[model samples]
Target chain A: MAKEPEQEFVTMTPQQKKARRSRSLALALALAAFVIVMYFVTFVKMDPSILNRAM
Target chain B: MAFVDKSALGDADFRLSEATAADFVALLKPRVMSLVVFTAFVGLAVAPAGMNPFLALVSIVAIAVGAGASGALNMWYDADIDAVMTRTASRPVPAGRVTPREALAFGLVLSGLSVMTLGLVANWLAAAMLAFTIFFYAVVYTMWLKRSTPQNIVIGGAAGAFPPMIGWTAVTGSIGLESVVLFLIIFLWTPPHFWALALFKSGDYERAGVPMMPNVAGDASTRRQIFVYSLLLAASGVLPWALGHASAFYGVGAALLGIGFVHYAWRVLAQDPADAGMKPAKALFGYSLLYLFAIFTFVLVDHLAMRMIG
Candidate 1:
């Protein structure tokens, strides 16, 4: 497996850091989506809207 | 990654030499420093009194630097054992990329810088906590308990649990019961968290002769201790909201997470030895990360919400 970004630090410009941040956010969202799908199928079918409501 | 070949740097015609600025940087154990910084930040954010933003920043930076200093000193002292352990074989001092004297100098400098900066930027109370944290990690854990007994993680965990209280002191300039509660949560959480890793990394301790729980007591005893500590950790997880340091949102979230922790512990204890049973221990280890993150995250969030609404 590839090393996680937070596990190592590399010097980068502000723009490079922005790009990296976006990539990380995208990956995290994708993983969260996968978990949500798995839960709905295998476990509970809760509404995603509940998150906003809880806030 | 292949562990055996990881330390080729050690064989680069390596004689113990003075470490450069970069090697000294690595000695601080930046990975552990991040977790310490995060929890400490949460503690500062949730403290009853407000602190100056720049001073708060300075305090957090100083605390992290102090933690790194402690790590460097530990690496310097433990270089002999570290060179033999696969996991730590590549550390600067152990790998001969750095000399012990160089690491010692670097740690001493950082320890002084962090403590002095914290005192100037924050209150003396916060600075004292930072200094004490470095001393506890360097002297108590690294010098004392690490070699003396297998219960090192249990006692030495106090060193790791100091961040939240330190952060709290930075803002309040005095210790609060709530801050102590935060410390207790991490204190209780450490044993099981570390013991699980020790369970799987049994060979590492045996090879290094570190007297880890698995190496000294036995696997069953380690597992039982993990379960007991997890039980206490779960109880402490709910204490913040129960004592009214937090609000309902935190209370409910903690209860659920506490149940999840207990469930993970149960699976680790009752499961049979096989590929199948590995999953639970692994799950507990993984969730344990989330457990600490969520608890501190909740504390910060709930505290922020109250501040805004009030």
Candidate 2:
């Protein structure tokens, strides 16, 4: 019986690498925007008394 | 025509994907999303109650994302047919720039995020309507109606028509007759707009096995239907004024726009079949888009003017 050859990993080209990096950046920005939106939404939903509470 | 099974293409058969961020954006059907956003904004603007600016921004973003998510899901499901249709052949999913699995996951994630965000920032009713709109577009229209029925556009138009109602609910916390009139205008306008495209591009739809009106009912019947729908659409365009929700100024503008739409449709109806160019249908299709935009602009301006006068 003939021995099977092992498969080698394929390396990504520079173009593929750049594409992946850009996609990562976009995802990061989108997630950060979502967080900021949620933060502001929290303030918007809060009662005015909360901000005026005696310290 | 040879159909390449994109799903079957193994990693070994292709190089590493170089799909860009723009490709992912394209999956959102940005053009359609813009119209949804614009209509939703108009709905929000004309509501009896006003929303906080921040919350209004959130509502519009969530609605836009939900609509885009549905579009992504549609691209995922219809990729096979999309590959065959000339108009859709270059779409990210069908063109091999984005995998089906990627598109499905992207759509699902966006759908969840959008619905939750809308619910938290607005009210649950608006959120629920957004969810229903997404489901209706992705499942009912794309998966079921489109391939099986010639009346697909008529029924599926409901999905596109929901954005204004959702926007109204977001601001007022309930639906209103004004929003319903907006919905009706879009609903009645859809058939003539889409059927006009189908008239010109029936070959693309036929090759993709989609049962468009021209392919299923023949050109003559489709043209007649377009003319009839044009009349109804024109009437519906003036309904906000008739119902006293809008001013006479809006009524006049809407009436003129409706007359323009009907004239375009008449050209389509009177066009000779042997001409082969289908120029009238193409012209009607372009004019239909302008008509919708112009009508909505009138609604917004009318609302502003009435508020100032009062």
Candidate 3:
């Protein structure tokens, strides 16, 4: 069946693009920090070899 | 109740509903999901050591959700080109049954839920693999390679191939040589299987501005590459037998399927693309799906049988 007609892909304005890029970078850094914290809090103390037996 | 009472719309309204349903289903990409889920399940079922049944169930559900999440995100980003391609024009976002924003949100939620739940229910390693699989499919494949080169599917196929390895990790909580073999089979199989479809649908992709193999490499070169990959696929499918990951049943079964694959590829290579006969290309497309499913199913069943006999 027929659907969306020929609208072009929406191009973001430069300001929006810049803001998005910055926000994404900040979020990625934040996520990395969270991972680091979680690693020590949860993963660091766990023995990895618990898995070797399953293997 | 008030909405139904109004009933001002014509029969065309009902027709549109059916069409919209079809389009939304298409957004899930059942054919692609089938291959992904089947291989992933086989990987889980055939792991060296048994997984807790509940954990295995969770692993499969997570993997499937991750796959569907990737599919949804793909629809969100590719809505523009999706509107252009006849084959894809009716997908959810393109057809307006779902908005790009809605699709994006659905994808993001599914991705997070699948990864986190998988990690909690199974091993962190499998959860991590699930996370990587989502990233690989959504960001690496849909965002990057898809627009860049003729080799897009070649590299992007790795995202699809990870299911077995993820399954292995879910059970074992670690990677091993066996899971790697499972990965290699799908990696080698992807190009030829996809290029066969591209061989015939070159016009569809070319019009959409997607740089698929046929669009970039030209038809003759693409067909030759398909033949080459087909040979490599045949070689890899037999590795489980050679490496002792499986028994004689899988070895013989995979070899037979691989030979069928090569035969169809040879037809595509030798056929006059200018001719009216599209049978060879179509056959290759259909057989490729069966080939992958059969090989993995064989591996799973063989492993189970051996366990029982032993």
Off by over 4 Å in 1: A1-55, B1-20, B274-277
Winning model by lDDT: 2
Candidates 2 and 3 compared by TM-score, better number: 2
lDDT of 3 by residue, B197-228 (tens): 88778888988899998888788898899899
Identify the leading candidate in terms of TM-score: 2
Interface RMSD of 3: 17.7
Better of 1 and 2 by lDDT: 2
Predicted complexes: DockQ each? 0.01, 0.34, 0.02
lDDT of each residue in A1-55, candidate 3, tens digit only: 8754432233455654554565456557746864554455345436788878953
- Cα error, residue B224 of model 1, in Å, equals 1.1
Q: Extract clashing residue pairs from model 3.
A: none
Of candidates 3 and 1, the better by DockQ: 3
What are the per-candidate TM-scores when only chain A is compared?
0.56, 0.67, 0.59
- Ranking of all candidate structures by their lDDT, best first: 2, 1, 3
Best by DockQ: 2
